[model samples]
Target chain A: MRDKTDKLRRIAIEPVTRVEGHGKVTLLLDEEGRVVQARLHIVEFRGFEKFIQGHPYWELPLLVQRLCGICPVSHHLAAAKAIDQIVGVETLSPAALKLRRLLHFGQVLQSHALHFFHLASPDLLFGYDSEISKRNILGVLHKHPQLALQGVKIRKFGQQIIEAISGKRIHGIAAIPGGMNKALAPSVVSTLQTSIREILPWATQALELAKQLCLADRVHFDGFASLPSRYLSLVAPNGALELYDGKLRIRNSDGSSYIDQFDPCAYDQLINEEARDWSYMKFPFLIAEGPEQGWYRVGPLARVNNCDFIPTPKAEQARQEFLALSGDPLVHGTLAYHWARMIEALHCAEAIDLLLQDSELCSDDLQRQGQKSNEGIGVIEAPRGTLFHHYRIDDQDCVETANLIVSTTSNNHAMNESVRLVADAKLSGREITPELLNLVEVAIRAYDPCLSCATHAVGQMPLKIELHDVRQGLLHWLHKDQRGDFVAA
Target chain B: MSGMKSAFSFDGIQIAFTSGQSIMQAVLDGGGYIPHLCYHPQLSVHGSCRLCMVKVGDRYLSACTTEAQNGMQVENQISELRELRLKLLEMLFAEGNHFCPSCELSGNCQLQALAYELGMTHSRFPLQYPTRKRDGSHATVFLDRDRCINCEICVRASRELDGKNVFSLSGRGSDTALQINSEDGRLGSTDLIATDSSARLCPVGALVFKQGNYAERPNERLYDTHIISETGNRRPAVVSGGYPELGE
Candidate 1:
């Protein structure tokens, strides 16, 4: 690969599209036609931490939800849980806990559905190298209309459940510090029960489609960004899959339990964030292993890999099938993220069904009154991964300090590593085609990283890729326009 | 006192009000609409929000402070006044740390409701991100100055209705803020009670009742089901009784 006379160059992919917020991928190359370094940079910053300082602690639940519209419920609940600490409540009321769980289930289901059907399905159903304009949700609509409709219905059902419980679907102000403010009315409970049953079939079909895709494209699924990394997620006391309330669990890359039953409030002791000058997002790693060696994966792939078993029957069956693909506890295939996401969606639907049937869901015991504490930490498994919201309040009950570890920020290292691996393997001294650049995006998308939430910005991203010669500069540039076409810029 | 009532046209609709009533009061009484942050039905009109600006005979004036007069044609819904109000809303958003997602008064906040009414998607101006302080010093009343739009509703209510003068506006222009009326400038040192009219008069999340935070779920808040334009001064009956009990 050596061409000593050739000059080194840099390739840049700016504003990575269809993955929530503004981000770019840069590839550094050596004179010998070898990839030197790959970096994922987050461009936008909303200064949520600096601005949220003076707000009251009780206002956090609703305030943090503004982090991402895609997974507002996660931030909403996570912040609420943190404020619950400030409120000095050890646990929420039974009814409040159940209601919050229902809300979370809806969030997970909708968010996963959105990722698979709206963002990823176009790539999965159509080939990865399909036409740029055709590789989108609208293309899926034109080709597989029924599947598209099912996707819409499933997402709608989840959003409706959220709206039914809270007041509105997005940024619903239901959860508060101690507990939630309102209970699910019996009428809404009945409506959810009826709708969830209908949605279950679509969720099941989604899981089936994901499984089929994984089996059919074994080479792509197995080799594409298949980095063996440690997995971390929240789990129930019994080591079952748990999203809403649980202790932190970590599984080694070789399919062995590393840490179990650690309290999330002490997350600072277990997890540490590494700041890099290249990106605004911080890379979070397990503290014991150090930053370089401790980078771990989160979200669906990690959740499925870390959990001992999924409680619901259908999801459990799907999980078993998914595990059979690797025969290892930790599945390394990045594409398997889609499979795990679908299975979780199935589980979310099943959980919603069960929760809706619980009569206590309609109970009016939504909140508990309590005195405020000066400090508190709240943690939950967001749709993207583990989220931590820590706050220090003054005697006046105002938030004096706030530290938020969002899901995307936690997966920062893994995403960058995947992007590097894909770029090194595919784009070494070659013309950067739209398909090659999209492969890098595919690696990032596998994590379902929400850059907007990571940077706390409020705009959608449009990806642009550029190649530059070391001496001459300005080789070529490709940008995805508003119409989803990769136009040569 | 004159026995006859004074009627005026607002947005092409005729509205009648008692003599000396402001245009905002007349609109509210007649079930008409005008976006306002400082004006309250039972409190003195403090047209500080400037959100209630309306065109009267080609000249723009605040509806909250301007009295309704016979044959006065008010252009509350005109495109120019609407655009001006939207701009004012944007300025209010930029001048303060109004994070709606985290605000307790989000769904019920007059500022938020008015923004939604006017379809304000995002603020055009750069955020000032002023470093405001919170006064959790009160026992039952918490004050988050960050969310305060400087509408002066709490200040007016404290001075006009409560008579305790627990709250007052201090500073100038962008630096203006609601100040607690006590030697130490803390709510805890003041005589303001949880049930004081001033405590409940805040249009934003600035003056929130302690222990009652998140008492109303997001969906059932004041403006969730009905827009402020439609609801006007008639608060939702569900929230009219104050915070709901955990078992209610």
Candidate 2:
């Protein structure tokens, strides 16, 4: 018989699935069943930083793209821009600049569509507590075949554009140091223009679905991992929404005025990274606020919250409606990340349409050559958030040092905070069910953290959850089995 | 050299070559496929990769070094040879850090193309994850030893073609590595230049031109659309001697 005095217990989840990389969650409980600590643990280590040291600076655009298959263009362009700085090119040629922008729009569109349709819609369309097998993209296809087809088409269209411009969809080779290595052929441009026009309505439907989900579960949306934190994003020179390149902007948690604005090259002066023992990912915070008080958020929700205006008309309409949810400039609900992602997808489609119409996109003058310098920093807005690539070169132009602050890494602290919040609110002394444990993951998924990019782990994301007590041993261990069903181990 | 040329059957196709030419050379000269890594026409055959193993009678021999005799029947594309080559390619992939996506020579990389040609989806062997050095000490050349298949093309090119012994193989077995000729083992201290034959001799991303990296868009590279076997038409012209014509 079990002792009545054995009050302490523990819970653990391992090998989390349906995400981009390997991660786990651990929960510690006190004698009274109150949660003491909850943490997200990134288990894998990819030595991209260590391996890139001896390579040449010019190889970084290609080297860093290997960091994540889903968003290689973000890293490619970021490394290129940094190299551009090292080459001492103040600005890219007009034609090269437009082509790079077009590539970025394609990247964001594809990634957002993947996250929304493949990962998030499963939980939204089916109830969070529904049968695990039915809560996936396949299930979405089984019930809503047309919607599933649209999702696949949307993602394919974005991938096609990437392939047409660069070469291949996964690790394309187009952007170079000073500019792009190639220009869009007239034939490829015409094909992309037609595809974008056909896909805009589907993007709008995705936005509508997100809005419906948000309205249907207002209470859950309002409280699910909804914590007050500062928002960070990139803004154009005119204070408009910018994804590919822009000035860094910060806004306080209460929908107040701007905290700071600075050039992306000067990121080190404004933002600082704090390394934690549990995870390979580093926590980035505002330099002035310090680590304890400086925890901020980036990504879709943060981008929508911080931007003054989105330039595209349809996206702007979605943004205005999203802002009306709270009647304030900032929306703290973590679930709203799904809504923000859909809105960004719409914006990307509209931006692609506008760029395709530009005659300069078809120009043959692609890249420029320049003198090399000693140091460079490139920053761009990845689908997840702001990505920074910093490099220092030797006299021979070989990379002496490389530092990358990916978008998911920037949101590390806030993600941990959200996990703690969800676990604290949901798991009190009751028996932990798969449904209860999934709520905790919903909080982490809301950030749409790309552990592959954040931890630099190769391949698919595997997640696990653990619950523990102070005196007792591990109470429960839950994780996705080989068939992707959440099973107790 | 003999005045009479030898004719051989390679994978059911008749190939004619000089008496002194090896089976691999005959196959390449005839534009037939037999995967090879170290056997450059301009360099001496190393036969280390063993990817060009072919069935002759009941036994197998390295095609790159085995001479093509008159009426020699070489089973180049048989299932046995194909399986052996696939195993060799898989071993090479597991033995090195061949992260294709991040590699600068992804589409143009000969090793990658050969893998695709052989229908190699993934490596079956356990990855060694060896810690290899990347030497960017050269002013115009970048040497990532991690991707080296030890084809010895650079070694032979430096010694035989460029007349500058800039590279050599060191150690043995798993610990074996490509070493530079400089006292400090740095390319910057060597006489090798960007235009040197040794610099362009690498069949992989191991030795690459620093400035020209990714200059040709990936889609337009040598092996993007077509496999290495189909690149016979695009192969650079071999001059009067054995060496390929320079600056083609």
Candidate 3:
């Protein structure tokens, strides 16, 4: 086959299935042995922030939870907290605050577990080509039924706790602006305590399996390559780690400079987003510079980096292991996503256990019964990362503008960079193998980008590297023998 | 949100009821099942379901139409209303869809249930199906067109309750078909999303479920009315959660 050097070839991933959000990737490469361009695109944009304007403050929890089906509880509480802040409404009681924290932890635990085992584990575990449809948790079920059941049980436990406390599993109404709608009943508390204790062992086993899997697939850990980027999160005034609600802080990968103590209300001033035409997800960066200059990462990596201390002992242990891997204070290694998730899960269980055990949690008085309506802001660490829901309201307490920045958007720059690096390493290599492509795809999945929450942008394909003269691309070539009519790539 | 605050004062207890439910429905829900002759718990709440009427301020209105206020003084079981309700029941039994013996819903009919409560021996009004057909084209449920009372229970249930808009009235006086609008004509044509209100709206044997026929006779089963009315009252605004708020 001729080198077909002059013309350009385009590879467009339309309606990227298996991923949570609407996203596309364009890989463009020239014939020579050099990289060209890599663009990640998010295609759909339903202006939810604009839509949420003029809603009643009481309805913020319900309204914001609509942001994503995958993580409604996070948005619900984030919006609730925001409303609370805007009105200067502290939680009605400690019990309500405790319950809110417990559920938020559950969100983190379950979401992380789902992302790792179900969505992003295929390529690392079964080598990606093990059948696309069967490459789900069901595939794990066929092989390791007990493990799959354990995963399901763990996720269900998280959901059950939320349902038991919040009134519903998905869009829970318990967490209001001032406080929770209802306090945890004695029977429900007892059930949760027992259930959490029971699930801990299963969670431990799953974590062990995850660790083994990570070690087994070291070569595929090219996605774990360290990148120098800033980490952002919310921390308490005393510099203690706070996930529920706190001041924003951004720290560079090196322990050099931490953007000390900024209010979340000033987020619009700090970070600006540039939307591309191709993808639904928008590219967000520090307002100082555009993508080329203002690339930063958030979520697991950022949270751990920004926080000065881990409150829970188990989480601290995992954090130590995380730091040891890279010998760097900030673990830029994406492969550590598994470790970060497990640590967060353990932290969640521990936090919930502590919260449930609180004497205040059993109080009969839950809501701020006699309190007046007020505007507020709720900032929390969603399972993926930092989440902020800001709401402005009128005198009648109707919400004006509701601006939300999900954790996925925080990691947009890092995700693009990670994909670009992996694409360069794998596709630019001497062989354009299926394993390489799978590895590259898996690398992107490691970030667990919720493109639905993020803005969409165009996918610019990197120039192709023709290692060997080929008749067609791998997908086209593989299907040629099976079907009567096969489209050439 | 302020209309008649002190005008409808009880104690100082505020409650949140589901949207679109009537005050009588709300009171009956909170374990105070009000009794009256015109209130046939099921039949499209005739405000005529007036058997459940209570005092709303100085003006006496049907509780089925008047929404519950936070502190409304409600008079469910008053001494003076018993004779009036008995008289209303006597008038209702005189109307159509009251074939006690041959009726499929005989043991469990709302009219029968109310008739037994009001101690009515016989109807005063004439027996009038008025040449109504047994339009039973629905494969699953049979509709005794003659059994329908034209109370618009099925129509309201189909449109408001189920959000399917499958049932509609065809004629004015006595010629209405419980038309399962097929081909946009009857309900069978449109997709009927089964909801509790839709299932509960059948006052007579006008609409019967395909399955569970004669499964549990009314006498044997507990219609204990209080629990039944609780769920009937709290028809959730966003019942299934995921469906957007009604207007949204």
Candidate 4:
């Protein structure tokens, strides 16, 4: 882990394990003992945009859903928004808008639930050093079946609400340009309302347990408690927090530093991605100062920092508690995820209640009665962060191109920097230990990067240890000596 | 487009539907039951049991291809059409090695039910069970060369539904032989994950489910009379099948 030369050298880790999807991380160390160059590699490329070159614009929503299983709704919404732009379907009635917001809320709630329980909870609950076999949700079930069942039910409730609104569970048919495919029937709305009410108690209990477990080991949040970075997110026209569709804004950790609102179509002017050879995930940075200079973050921490207020009372209260815990609007980036999730759940329940009261929900007319072909873009805040899907269509409106900017891409720069800070702060000028390395890896996973959605990449951690003899002035590679017993490397 | 809101408004009208459901299901659930040839109740829908063609809004469409709609009219009571459908079944019988006296499916076969339903007294088409090959690839299931109807149900079900496009018809028209997709023409060749669901949807005895053999016949089956709206719906029904309930 120590740098020997007086020049910056590249260190890369490929196929990062135990995290969602593929990703790679490459660090460039300079003579000053700091990261001179940091590039996150995002490798998976399905050419989804290329494949949609001739697809009808009407099929964009469903086609884009296949882009990422974790946040299909984000893409579905983005495509619809893009089409709404082309078709001149700008204004959504209050009822339609409420329903759209509810759908977005549902997706964020479920996706965050999945990330916490199925993905990150294992490491938190079972102590990262637990045997591989016992480091999964199923393993948790073996130890505490009732808790596992409760988590599963909460996750299912979110999905069921989605299924009730949209015809299918995975690829919801509800979101359409201008409005939705089908309005919620009275029975469906009632069922969802009842389920949400019933699950609220359980959700509260689960949240309490997560907070307790997270704080049980104070060391979990103690690592690399460095100064905060810039945050970015979307804000509603009325100044209330909006995740589905909003104007983009950037703010610093202090909350006093800010930037002007920008249109998403001008994303090229605001953000850019950097590629490194070691990892498949790319580091996306703000484009204010050139592609590589502007360091910014998206997702939970960014959302909290960028927005002035949340719509739901309970969520707003949670935001207050979050700021209390961290003192800064960025709110201790590590714990920002917990705040993001609670806010999403509260917003989801409140939005669902609002949508149910709308008269348009009871209407039988789900479709517009006719199909119109036009390009569309839908942008929404996924659980991980901001998501955008941009589509182009030809005459007769077949899809000409479908480009997507996943939530994880927005946080790429910050995540890489997080890893570098943890490595430098925790292991600088000191001997490297397996415990320290694992902690460094944990710091990166805290952001919950979805590299697969971005570049179809996976992350790999390759630890290189070199022993230097002060008398010798040179270090020897320990890899060859440990080879036969070094497992699979 | 119609303002009809009553549940029974379209009763006895035989409305044509052609989007999602199979023909046999449309006939049985749509209130008019058409005698089927080579169709099974438990397996996936197979149009090879061609006895369910009813005149759609205008053109004749296989009931299986049409998803039922609200008001489009339909009819299957034409005598000439009934006679034509029956005649085809008889032709299929005479051309194959069908011996009811020894056949195990004689009492439950869809072809047999159609014969009784249509009152077929004799087979007019000449008999010709051509010399063909039959290889028993798996230990449990046996393939009978004399029984295949060249219906392409097994082929289509395997390819489209299962995503394993294995089976294909080699020869054209009457000379078609069901070839297991391999250059060597051996069933053992290729990446045929036997667990591939294509064979599970086989209508006739061509690809029998190893577990549900000698199960209930159409007359005693509940799903036969009622449409299976959901795949895993397990409503209590006449348990004439040798196999026990799946979840049990």
Candidate 5:
């Protein structure tokens, strides 16, 4: 058999930087200088499911949060919802439900705001092709100090909401099996009430800035790494945008509906996950579509496109303008994710403002009683997309089996496809350019793919772009680390 | 000591106790600290965990089992004894499936609190991930043998305090097991009520009220604010269902 690597020159971008955790993108080009294959590889294989088998069922919400640093709250809520079923509580108390919803809004708001303003802005404000040193959060602070300050305070406000209710900013113990652990203190509600007044307007400004940036470069923005594929998210019973709890909505590339109200409990029957050799992340597809044609997208762009309308007034107005950007039923541009994310941030801020006013939040009637269930499935729209946590417990209340399809896992196929399309369209020869890296990286970055996304600064990874001939190996390499300057390693 | 005198100096302080009193009881009465688990004052002494090993003269012995004597010169915090106590704590940690972060007994656990007070960072030995079974069939109580230190406090409590004889040890040495003396070998089938001393006497998170986690929040849990050595292993005011039980 002939070795396939004999003819292909590999342009390997090891560890795409600035997103939580990291991934590698490899563009394989044949001797004719044509891009042959593009693959995004996630090497991490966290055995949380297998290892968590024997833990008490209630510890799941706390345990699964370790899966994602950026969106632990999403995992926590998702697992808690599943446990609610296990413990047999059909409906949480009004007070319990409101506190959970408030926590979810805070999570979505902080995550979306941080993603748009802190991580994705530098790529937009300073053009992608700009030098790496000036294309970062620091650079945004250097030129647009006021905008940077708004991003910081808005994110802080969102986190403050989380801290107020959950006790701490992350990995907090807010939701118990049947209900929340504590009532939201009136003082905390008052403090958050004061903070949201400033955040709502700032969220509006961020949304406008995102919309403006995309408008400035319509041609590039509309087409960069864009792909037409299916979209999936959670929507309210009335077909409105819902992030915390709702039925599943799957839409076609043309904005036509596939299934609008699939039961979350039957997610395993609706979605089929296929494992591939190249990546630890599984490729999930609709049961009807099969693996080849069933690949779909889930995240900000998908959520925005799949829903009828966002519930909050300001965000609903923003969504209408977003939909107006295209004559087609849905917007497929990957860059539009930032614009949609900011819209959700505004909605979260509004939701928090609305939730804080509910007097039930201060009620002592927190817990609900229920019958015991053996299995449960929970689904929620994390800032990234739909997160599913399904668990089955033994009679002893130990987690007998667990199956999780985090938002990033659900988008694995789409992220790979987006980057592949970009590499195929942009790659001409063996040469690797900053513009090419920008487009390929931005494709996945738009997903804000939570690859071990840690906010820790102590161990920021070095990015390596390698040119390799499979036969000779390691032809040339360029490196970028915490110093933010590219070096020929 | 209770005024019965056969005086012994502990850490350069005179601690007087009756001839038949164990060193642990004397230490307690003398207002001195010696970290211990499986040595509750309310339960019969088991001396299973060697955590309270102290050097008397040239040999170390379990303080709860060793009787107080005149001119004993027992040392609880000597270099040899401190290292040995830490080794014992580390062994218990390694032998069990004790992921304290996930364990409901976390801050309230005497084993955990004692480890914290001793300044233990990590276990030197690799964890033995035993195939332990957790029993949650009981309506209100849970039994997770993963965190069980084989102390037999539950066994003693059930027989001596609750008068149920619902628990007993079934194996020997490292393989020792807590057998629920029920027709189906389950706690739910046994006469072990949630309020039974057996259900609450485990020093670790081996047994606990099923819905008791995060009841007082982390900051208010038993050992959260008070060091186990200083607080003498007493629990914080009990909070059930997010409300502190009245009449404390």
Candidate 6:
């Protein structure tokens, strides 16, 4: 099918669905029907930095959470931390810090559980080449009801934690400049404690399921989208796994450390973002490696690989089992993202349990005052990976400039690379079949790219990639309203 | 200003007020709610928002501007006036940007609280989408003209309470807007200190202090927890943390 009269034909996946935000994948093929290039395009740019420039310093946390519905807590906390710097509060009260940490862990927990069970689980539970009609969460419910229930319960548990701390299931404000707005009530703590009894076991069960599925079929899972470059995440001062607060650490693919104990505020010196003409998203890279080789990976895979060890007991036990996958220090298997993500989810659940017990969780010392500063930066390990929020406020206490590197933005280059590898290997010379088109979607879903800003932009076709057996986008990348039952690509 | 007191039936109950008390203020002081945005108890009645439009006999008058006469049957919950006020409220929303979901004053904004009080599900009118100016030039306050309903409560407060006359209106009709009284038309250039007595009484998100934007949980906000009838005409006190500061 000739879309354009040009020599190269484009097989485009307009609006990759089952992710947080909108994204697209265009596979350019030569006259021979050989896939030559693939580009994951974030068609829309929200221009949040420019939108946030004129806002007051305190509005940063409240305003920036409009970025993504899925990971607003990450944005909320990151912006709050940056505001802390603007307010010149270096350390928060223990209660405030604890509340913020609890919020972050909840964000990661629900996000990972949602990605694995709601979005990515169908592909894991059912084979990649399985029937499009039966390869979804519904299908999982029919086949593996217990596992599916665990996934839903796990996601709910995480969201409940968020609500307990932030006041809402989504877009609730927990963090404020220099502290937290509210502390958990004693009743709320008791309620969370009641819910955790059921959730902790479910989280471990979910992790065990992910581990067993991957380990049983190691060969298929390991090599699927196995294009490793480097990894980056936030770790504690003592080199322990930390999600909420930590220093930036990067590890090379070949058992070497690119950087360690890197100050997050000075990330400008360590990282650089390169813009290309094909995509709206900027490819961020390590300043040491440069753009050509510096494109690194973030999120669960990177966090698990880069961190020295997990802090919580159950997650640490699971991490030990996951690390024994190979003799090498790092796990480069792309599909292991699901496994690594569950490990983190387990850690978050356990952490939530421990935090619920802490007496400081209900303390009223929720805020502190400090002298003000002009510039501030906050970094944290979001569910997707490292999220950075930097701002420079004018003397009027309004934001003059805002520099944000969201988790999905950081993984732009890595996703594109993964798409390219999968397309080149599967669709280069072979006939483009229905199952083959889905393989491309499967590869992209592993990274769980948010493509958040595209929906906000005008004139961009917001199509959904029905890879989760939603009864659409099987043969066609973008479906038209044909009178018939289906539209073929 | 007469010393004698008079009674008037508002919505239902006969609320007693001293002579020269506006019907809106009397209903408010009598623990009754007639949805309003611009009418602050401490400020002079401007009757700009038109949200307090009530049926007084055969005429529809803004309750704040209308004086409460003895035995005057004022209809606060009449269908015609309710529908008219609904449209008026919709116009107030359309004429300006009042995106409460993202607004820092979502739960605290008097305009938002009244909308909920009036059961405003959606606006029937098309948004004017006027290109409004925002003044973040102030050290601690933000002047977002987009969310301004042109109520001019700030104008009255600045003139009457603070005696600063720092806020005033500039245009007429469609072009009417609140203008910051400074050399460059910027809030920063004025004598608008963050601690000015009348600084935080704009009744909207327009004149917002730049601290603790989202300090309260949704259910814990003023409007979320209490109806306008229950709270009367007071802006919930704002605290350093996101909780509302009460006069402890």
Top DockQ hit? 1
Q: Which residue ranges in model 6 land beyond 4 Å of their true spot? A: A1-21, A30-34, A428-430, A452-486, B1-7, B12-18, B126-133, B136-140, B180-196, B239-248
lDDT score, residue A426, model 5? 80
Question: TM-score for each prediction?
Answer: 0.86, 0.87, 0.62, 0.60, 0.91, 0.90
Predicted complex 1: DockQ: 0.62
Q: For residues A359-404, write the lDDT of model 6, one tens digit per residue.
A: 9999999988898889999998889889999999876677889899
**What is each candidate's DockQ, to 2 decimals?**
0.62, 0.49, 0.02, 0.02, 0.44, 0.59
> TM for chain B in all models?
0.90, 0.91, 0.65, 0.66, 0.92, 0.91
The local distance difference test score of model 6 is 0.77
CAPRI grade of model 1: medium
| Distance from true location, Cα of A122 in model 5, Å | 2.2
lDDT of each: 0.78, 0.80, 0.59, 0.58, 0.79, 0.77
Candidate 6 DockQ category?
medium
DockQ, Cα level, model 2: 0.49
CA error at residue B221 for candidate 5, angstroms:
2.3
Location of the lowest summed lDDT over 10 successive residues in candidate 4 chain A: A479-488
Clashes of each: 6, 23, 54, 48, 4, 4
Stretches > 4 Å off in candidate 3: A1-21, A30-33, A128-134, A217-225, A238-240, A289-291, A369-375, A428-437, A452-488, B1-248
Candidate 2 error regions (>4 Å): A1-22, A28-36, A395-398, A449-465, A468-480, A484-489, B19-27, B43-68, B83-96, B119-133, B159-165, B168-185, B216-220, B233-248
Candidate 3 docking DockQ: 0.02
lDDT (Cα, tens digit) per residue for candidate 1, span A291-335: 989989889999998998999999999889889876465699888
Interface-residue RMSD per candidate?
1.9, 2.3, 20.6, 20.9, 1.9, 2.1
**Residue A361 lDDT, candidate 2, scale 0-100:** 87
Query: Model 1, A82: alpha-carbon shift in Å?
Result: 0.9
Measured on C-alpha atoms, candidate 3 has an lDDT of 0.59
